[model samples]
Target: MSDHFLMFVPTDPTWQPTKADAERAVELFKSIAPNAQTIEAIFTDDVEFHHPCENWSGVDCAACGADLEDWFYETTDKVYRENHFADLSVTTPCCGLHTSLNDLNFVWPAAFGRFALESMRPGLDTNEEQEKAIAACLGSDLRKVWIHL
Candidate 1:
């Protein structure tokens, strides 16, 4: 079975909204995607990566645009095992430049954050203005990720 999710994650990897703000954002998203089967905000103790699941295409080096899918998996695994993603710092394998797993260019628009607002099976798409409103409710800029799994 496969499911689709529309998720909004904070741009800052370690940012988390207050429970009240998260609840408000959930309500706003529900209003925007009224027919969605479920809508909620997920809070975590440490920064976690949110990928587009089966919708993922691949990733590229943010600095040089080199394909970095293999590097991404290796690096993310490294950090996840090291500290469950509590720290996201790293050096780009392709360019030897300093960066982080969260800073890489994910082709399918993934993000790392301690907070995420997600809508499951929403037969709806939000316009820019609506998106901004939800972001305001969360008090943070957001990156939208479409996930299929």
Candidate 2:
């Protein structure tokens, strides 16, 4: 992987509808379906480890549709040998590492890189700012070194 990642959005509305809402809950849900569908479209291909290609020389693989299985397996092995079982479990499919976020196009590293984008949250008081802060917390240094024994 080239250390690039993408961001994904949730298809379903995370919050519940309030009483007396003009649009029925079902209609709102139906509306969100398209957004979710778009998200899915973004992640059409797996983030695989590929050799160099003609168009993008020196790039290991196409960031959009690369298969991450090898990387995941190697990473799992490396972490296991290093005795990091907890991290290993988190990366495993049984743990939902691949589909955890649902949207596939969001590159793991790039999406995670949002935190490293800045030293601290730009705005901390507002809800959006707070949410970004939280994401930054989880995003920084999400990468792990693959060790071979």
Candidate 3:
């Protein structure tokens, strides 16, 4: 089975939380999801993209149903050393089409010191009440993204 995570990010993409903010967010997450863990938000130039697929599987071109193995290989020189959160775009060799890596389906493990909370099982939807609670705790508007890995 794949793991699912819920990331609480600021409504503004460029906003980075301080250590105290991270701690408060952790507490807020823990109150809602007892198993929540806090990751500090780190500043990065690249925009983070998340894939919603299970276990990195099911990544195929939209125009043509082709696997992304070759596309991934051709796009990156150092495959193993590449940061999973880096900004990327995939040009489908099959159809000669291009798409943002973020637009593609994939699970993104929230990193770079961002306050991320994870739930291992699927279908654990965070209701509006819980979201409001978290927002109140953090004292800011937040956006939630689901990542299935």
Q: What lDDT score belongs to each candidate, Candidate 1 first?
A: 0.89, 0.28, 0.53
How many residue-pair clashes does candidate 1 contain? 0
| Candidate 1 weakest ten by summed lDDT | 93-102
Q: Write the per-residue lDDT of candidate 2 for residues 1-149, one digit (tens) a residue.
A: 22221222212212112322212322332233323321111221222222112222111123345555455446546754664332222333332443322123323222211111111111112244443442343332122111111
> Among these predicted structures, which one has the highest TM-score?
1
lDDT per residue for candidate 3 within 1-149, as digits (tens), equals 55666766655433455667657766666656664443334345544433344534445566666776556545544422475435344567778777754344332322222334334442456789988876776666666666665
In model 1, residue pairs whose N, Cα or C atoms come closer than 3 Å (at least 3 residues apart or on different chains), thus clashing, are: none
Put down candidate 1 lDDT per residue, 35-78, tens digits, no spaces. Answer: 99999989988887888989899998888999989888988998
Model 3 lDDT, residue 93, Cα: 72
- Per-model TM values vs. the true structure: 0.96, 0.20, 0.49
lDDT of 3 at 37: 40
In model 1, which runs have C-alpha deviations exceeding 4 angstroms? Answer: none
Error of 2 at 31 (Å): 30
